[model samples]
Target chain A: MSIYIDPAVASSLRGFEMPEKLGFGKVMAPVMFRAVCQDGCWSRGELLPYAPLALDPAAKVLHYAQSCFEGMKAYRVQGGGVGLFRPERNAARMVHSAERLCMPPVPESLFMDGVRTVSAYCANLVPANSGESLYLRPFLMGTQPDLSVSTSSTCEFYVIASPSEAYHPGNMRLWVERENARAALGGTGDSKVGGNYAASLLSVARLKERGYDQSLWLNPGNRRTVDELSGMNFFAVLDGELHTPALNGSILEGVTRDSLIELARDLGYRVREREIDIDELLGQVESGRCEEAFACGTAAIISPISVFGDGEREYRPAKAPGPVAERLRAALLDIQEGRAEDRFGWMQAVEAVGE
Target chain B: MSIYIDPAVASSLRGFEMPEKLGFGKVMAPVMFRAVCQDGCWSRGELLPYAPLALDPAAKVLHYAQSCFEGMKAYRVQGGGVGLFRPERNAARMVHSAERLCMPPVPESLFMDGVRTVSAYCANLVPANSGESLYLRPFLMGTQPDLSVSTSSTCEFYVIASPSEAYHPGNMRLWVERENARAALGGTGDSKVGGNYAASLLSVARLKERGYDQSLWLNPGNRRTVDELSGMNFFAVLDGELHTPALNGSILEGVTRDSLIELARDLGYRVREREIDIDELLGQVESGRCEEAFACGTAAIISPISVFGDGEREYRPAKAPGPVAERLRAALLDIQEGRAEDRFGWMQAVEAVGE
Candidate 1:
């Protein structure tokens, strides 16, 4: 798919000012990539000036929540280069989410085209800090203006970038949410859709009030096993082995979670994916058998899970951001930032734009 | 609160025509009611022309699925007057949906005023047909233009009306949806939000090809008891008694469902609200103990359920509009259409508009 570059894109990017302080997903890039789909056929992509989109009140995305998005980052590698860490995984996962909503799957090639084009154009905006990078938000929405309870015939896909710091909610404390189940069994739990995130805000808000930074959502199907965090996947080091919840249909198959598993294995750590029952996990954490735990995602690369509070019982891991998390984080970051060799071929380099 | 009357509303209402066919929610009313909210404070309501609403692409509702809605109706009661059928129930339910999405509840008085005021002003437009009325849609959406995944501080609430005939998908053959679920356990299932409806569309579309009118969604928590249809509640007549699923937290508390139960009980029919197991109901239907079944909503009111098509087994009800359903529907319609006494204190009479 050929990209139609608007002549104004360069001026927009050039005139943009980098904010004095960069926070996660707060400061947006100057330009964006947009594409439209009509009757299942997609149009050529465009690199245009960033602007607000016009939507109708009855648009399906506004009402029915027919929206999905992908989060990834373009980083300035240590030795003066730019790279994306497994962007194709995000692209593939977005397709899965779209299909779940009966929306046209954004083709893998188009998905790559959008991300790579945006990353290349916004390369200057890529933060040079070790944890900071240009965060790319690739989103698809159903924009049909109607009140019907059916799939929309028109859709728009856009890739917007936010240049900022790493999403490290340091030494996170979590609340074990029991009253609400995030995604139901046979529901859109595993998909990276806006609805999933929307459904999670209430719980997050409730937990935040109770001095918690996140919620350890249990599997909706059984309400027993540990599914994941709202936007991240969970992992615990039990008896010197890395254990994470298996993909149980309702947990988002996170890109970072997957990379961590492969990297951990290569780093000579035994990683096992299985159903971690909530009760058993709490027990293990309380008994100090589970050394440390953390959550992983594209935006927040790796956040140390400090403690889990379920009702009156509080289970604290032996360490937060312990030796294992620190090591695994370094191993993954090394490949992503080019500090170490791209041994696993996980990093995909993009051509940097001349400022 | 004072209403801002847009002059365009008068013109739009004057131009509206009664279409030859009113298929459910397809036809739109000429006028709509609207109100805005900012940081938990609400603006005065407005009655305006029904037209396209221009919304920002980055609006919270589109990006984060921050929206909720209510479905109710203004009926041509049997006494030749317009009256709303238990609108407060819809108001309470909308509040629940709003809270789920971290939206402030539209005040109960505001909710009642919006529906009643719109209905009274448009009373002349209420269809005079036997099964036709003005279907009202009250929805709230996050209107802030931002890409962040948090509750929008600014929101807009609207009540739009559409006069329509009965939603009679005659002799509905329902597909037992075992794989895909409409809402997650801790998800938005209990709330009448857009995401819940959008999630169920794929299943309905798939089943439509299989000659089914709707998909009978099971409870997402325990894939056991019946949850509901996309926008309606389910009912079954077993061994000459009225039965419906109890208000498990996951199922929406439907106004029509509540009304029907009361009507059935008042008419001296044995009404039971409890779990209706899918397999057991199928077995009962097959063995002829379950005489009939139907679905109910504000638009459809009461639609006969004919066949329950599970993948391997199909249970066809002996009677579609069974005796119990017919009796209950007639009694409710009589009260709604002015053909009987308003004995149960259900109807709220709206001011009649001069032709």
Candidate 2:
């Protein structure tokens, strides 16, 4: 890999100390991966000391939000080794997101190099505990110092790592958002871009005030079928079958969601991906036909949904942490942490620096 | 106004030179206005040298698009002075946009102080020409360095100025956008936020390739009625009357659009604000009843539309720069450039520094 390692990176990493209380995404690592793109030509990647970026006030990303990002993790394998779970999926999704916003894609090779280099150097930062890993965030943004409402001419990509504990939201209670749409029908909802998350902040704030953990977004086009949560995909176990929202244009194609489906099928369960109406799902929950519901994302592998708050009514699922969700979560984690056989070949091992 | 004028600001202004080619929003001034907010409490505004910002890589604005901005102009007013047109309106609209993204609003006093201070200090930057002015951009963004999907705890507000000529697209050719939507039904369409512009870039890129100037976006919900242009409001002269799309939730409430509607009414032209069906308007244009069409915005006060390209069919207006559009544009420019009386009290005078 033709990557430039800044001399200060080793010193910065040496001086860094991991805090005892490492919350999710709060304790950042000392070093970061950086790359730049001019017009359409990408530069070589660099491992630099993590520091604040000096950006022009008129940079396109600051005003136009032409940015996309990915979320993955570097797990501590069985014998102190680090492995990235489905890093290629994140690389592919990020390219799709960049295209949606008219940004130049970070080449797949560059993406892998960035994630692997960060994982290799920060191997010690990956927490040595079940469900705890070094959360890796790979983001690309337009950095051209122009104020015109157009595509930026230059861009920047960075991979920042966070040494943290697993995100445990306990059983989440979701609020059915009916008024504000997260993204438009033909909008950037399917892409993991900054605008989609920004558009959902208000709805999330409103739900939090009403004691809801997350906003269960509905399809903006129809306003009846279920979309996903803000940063996660939704799933429900109904009548001995696992059901989830299909790969609609407005729904984000989550890596964890797909893996769970495949893993569930392997565990002797039938999985279905189709449009799940909000009203019908709520009815199923109330009638006990839907045994359990859960949300999945890179941050929290599987967060069980205990209740659905739709206006004045509250529908509780039959099981908060059902057997199906527990089994799938354990199975996925075992493979990620190298406890189980790499049967699906999902993990990519990284050589720890100075090992 | 309790603004802190930095000592270096005077030297920065003195050493600055206006570029010969002052295109719209390209030639930036030497100084700017800035303020910081921590947990909803705003600091005093400051006028300092215009420079790059030091932001953390994990800043919430970079990843979540938690940003909003406003565009207005500082014109060389009567008696060799500088005046801001409807500055308070921009402040209020910015507040609305900030709230939509769950960011704290810059207090009205703080917002006015920032704009007025920048205008006063950079008074010479206000170009003296028929369709020229110092374009002022006031923006707010979240600055907290965290990776969680939530609002930032700290924020930054800035007012940047660009001395430039008017934006002229000539008689524009608009493409009727059918596949992509700029903003959703209950999304941030009405707000001056970054996500809306980011989402519209692809559509604009596609339309530009087809020999069109801009995308005439339709309402996302129905995909039939005209919402507006990408950044400007749409207008047409039908049967000798001024008609524009009403203030739909999905259409931005442009200050130029409102001002034109009021000015047209005062000029003895009947103006109607209603839902404009794209098909019906095309039919009227084909029948020669809709004589002319135009768009209005802060950057381009009035841009005449020559043709509308819709799926292999082209509809041309009878009068490209119709009499009504020409008259309205002239009257508006006259007022903005201080060639006429400020009858509506829309202009706020800013005392030039060292005057």
Candidate 3:
């Protein structure tokens, strides 16, 4: 793949040192990939030193939130290689998200070039741990310096990598967000857009004041069905069956959620994608029928849910890290870390740039 | 105002030349006002040359939509002076918007200093016309350079000016949007946040394709009652009585909308702030009871609505610019432009710098 390599990028990468404490999304890699689009035409991708972006004060993304992003990981394989897990899905999902905001999509080829180039150069940054990986964030934002509430004529796309440890929120306690809705019914809920995350911050802050780890958002339409937990998808194991919310336009179609659904079925567990009502799930937890619950996303593969706080009541699940969650997590990690056969054909291997 | 004025600001302002044709929000002023906040403590404001903001790629606002903004105007007032129309209202509203996004609120003093300083320096940019003014945009955004989904500890506040003609979508053809919602039941509808604008863009784009000038969004909860236009408030003259949407949590309490309601009442018209259902409004329009309709905002003071397009049908009001709309618009403009008596105390006179 032919791409522009900034002269300073090699030096930046060579001079950088990884931080000792690699918390999630904290330690940034030295280099990044970038491309621009103007009037629906995309420019070639480039690898440059990671630096601050000069955006006009009136840039559409700054004022109107015309931005979308994807979260994926590049892992250090057992055989001293770097691998991306189903990056094509993130590329396609980003296209959908951009279209929803009336933005020009970054073509699949350019998207691949961005992720692959960044990962190849940052191969040493990929953490060689059971759960840790180099977190890659591919984002696109409208850059046109106009204040009108219209589609921007120009856009910027970037791929930035963070060398980090696995995000583990131990056994989490979730507060049922009854007052605030994360996304509207026909809003940007299904897209990986900035607006959805921004809307969730206040709710999360309120819940945190009450000693909760995250807010369990309910569907905006009914305010009863479980939508999601900020960024991650929710799951519950009831009667040895895995149940999660369906893709109802208001829930983000999380890649980790999809992979877990597929992996659970392959492991002989009954997986169902249906509307899991919050009240019903809470009742099941109260009755001990819901054995375990967890949230899944690329950043945190699977985080166990210990308690659900609703109003003045608390409902605890039968198990925090239940048997089903443990088995599925181990199986997924085995494939991701290259400890097991790549039977699912999920990993895409990339050669290191300096190798 | 004891604010630090950059030396380059005077040069930038002196070099700026107003264009031949001034369109709304298109031609930006040469200088801007800025202030920074760290952990809720605001720094002194500064007036500087308008330039691109250098933001980190991982800034909270860039990826999380943690931004809010206010739209007010500095008008060429009587006696060759400049005045702001109800800027305190905008300041309060912006504080609300910032708090809704879990961001530190811009202090009222700092907010006033920013807007007033920008307006004072750009006094010459205030277009001397009946319907035109120097559009002042005061915005706040989270600027902390961290990728974690949390509130930013640091923020930046800016006041940018645009000199332009009045935004007049003369006799707008509105589409009754039944599908897309601008906001949710418990979402940031009342707050002037970026997410609400981003969500409404697609609906507006779709309506424009169908020969409609704007979309008349409905309540996200019922999808039946009239909410407002994307950035404007909805009003209808029903049986010679002015009616607009009440201050529901899902409706942005538009500054212009509130002023119009107050002005209409003062002008001896029966003002009613109640819910207006879409079906009932269309039926009234069909029966000729709803004589006129219009939308109101800071940029477009009062834009008449000519038609409402629902699926397969169009409802034309009896009067596009009805007597009531005209009277209210003229009365409001008179107060805003300093032609009418300052009975409401809505105008704040500002002394031009270097006068």
Candidate 4:
């Protein structure tokens, strides 16, 4: 499939200047990839200059939340080449998310074209630092101009990029969120839709008041088992073994989480995926059985956990950036930055297009 | 506070023609009301021609669902005058919904101004039929371009109207939604946010496949007690008494539902608000103890439920639109349409501007 390149995109890319400080998802790339879908038929992909989108006020995405998105990064690899880490995984997960909201899925081919086109054109924007990359956000939203609580007949898909530095929460303090559920049981928890994120803001606000970094959410059904953090998967290093919550229907399946699990297994570590009860884990932390815990996602590869505040008490993990977390973070970064061999066949290199 | 009326609005309203057929929320009014909020301060309100909104692709509302809205109507009463029903209740509820999503509330005065301004200008478009009126949708959304999962710093508020007909789901057949929950116990179910409606589309689609019109949602935590329909409150006529699920924090308090309860009480019908167990209610329906069940909202007013399709069995209500539902719907609409005396002081008459 051929993509139509807008003539103005060249000027936008040429006129752009890289900012000295690149925060996570702050400064956007000059160019974007877009495609429209009407009545299940997708339009030809287009690479255009980044601009504000004109949408009808009655669009379904505005009133019914018919939107889903994916987060991945384009890395400035060895020899100044660009590589995308597990782009197909994000495409597949986006399909799942779209289906959960009754939206038509973007074809895998179209998804790849979108990411690759943006990554190739914006290769100059991928940060040269080890932990920094051009973060690509591919989002699809219903654009039908009707104020009804049903499926949308039209959709708009776009891929936007941001050159960013590593987002380090500096040994996060997670509040045991026993009061608010980020996603509901049998709801849009496992999907990367906006509703789950919207439902989490109140909890994040309340946790901020208590001087916490993020929320350690429990399962929405039982409110007992540990689910995941707001946007990352949780892992606890328990007595030389790593244990994380199994993929319950209510927990989002994170790409970084899956990659780390595979990397851990390849490194000869015992990894267990099962339900981790909140109370039991807190007890383990108190008894020194749980050495350290960390959260992982695409934005921040790994965020170490220092303390878990439950009710009136705090359970301190024995190690903040313990040996296990440090090892995994370095291993993943090494692979992502092309410092190590891509033995897992995880990297997809894209040819750069000069302005 | 005075509102800035756009110069083009007068011509837009004058040139607009009502379509021959008006569906619910389909035909948009020619003009709209808008306001912008930066940080915590709001700009002056403005009334402008209804048009598409230009939003940055990275706006928080499109990515994180930081949006909320209210549904209401301006009735074309007797003597061709316009009246708003319980507009203050919707204003207060919009505040709660906005705060739930961490967006700043549209001040009650600002809210009333938006609705009243739109209502007054679109008075000629209000349908004259008993169940038809000018449906007004006042929505607030976070418009910040940042992508982090935090509260938005900038917001946009708009009120768009539609000359809509009565939305009648003609004797709805509800499927016992045992697998999917619309909202979570500690989630945004009670708030009029987009997430709750987004979470409900898949369930509605699934029920439609099974030959049902709507879903009979249960409590998200217990999954036993009745909660509500997608956008409406649930009510049942049991042994000649009116029964509804009590406000349990997970059910959206509907303006129509509250009005019906009050009107029923004044009409000398015993109205009870308590937890209604799903299984027990089904048993009563089977034994002919439950006379009829209906759903209420601003759009539909009263939707009679004729069949409850459980796993393999179906329980039929004794009446589709029972005498109780008909009487209450009429009593409520009578006040709205100015047929009955406004003893409850519910209607706020708005002066219409002639073209």
Q: lDDT winner among the candidates?
A: 4
Instruction: Judging by DockQ against the true structure, name the best candidate.
Output: 2
Candidate 3, what DockQ? 0.88
Clashes of 2: 0
TM-score for each candidate, following the candidate numbering: 0.94, 0.99, 0.99, 0.99
Residue lDDT tens for model 4, A184-284:
89999999999999999999998899999899999999899999998999999998999999998999999999999999999999999999999999999
Stretches of model 2 off by over 4 angstroms after superposition: none
Candidate 1's displacement at residue A118, Å, is: 2.5
Ranked by lDDT, the better of candidates 1 and 4 is 4
At residue A227, give the lDDT of candidate 2: 93
Question: Candidate 2: which docking quality band?
Answer: high
Model 2 chain B: worst 10 consecutive residues (lDDT sum): B346-355
Residue A291's lDDT within candidate 2 is 89
lDDT tens digits by residue: candidate 3, A18-69: 8789898878899989999999888889999999999999999999999999
Per-residue lDDT of candidate 3, residues B1-355 (tens digit) = 4799999987898888899998888889999899999998888899999999999898989899999999999988877899998898999999899989999888899999998899888888899988899999999999997889999999999999999898887999999999888788889999999989889889988888899988898999988888999899999988789899888888999999988888888878898889898998899999998989999998888999999999999999988888877888888888888889989889999889874
Task: Give per-candidate clash totals.
Answer: 11, 0, 0, 0
In model 2, how large is the Cα lDDT of residue B141?
A: 96
lDDT of 3 at B194: 91
Q: Per-residue lDDT of A52-102 in model 2, one digit per residue for the tens? A: 999999999999999999999999999889999989999999999999999
Please report how far candidate 1 places residue B254 from its true position, in Å: 1.2
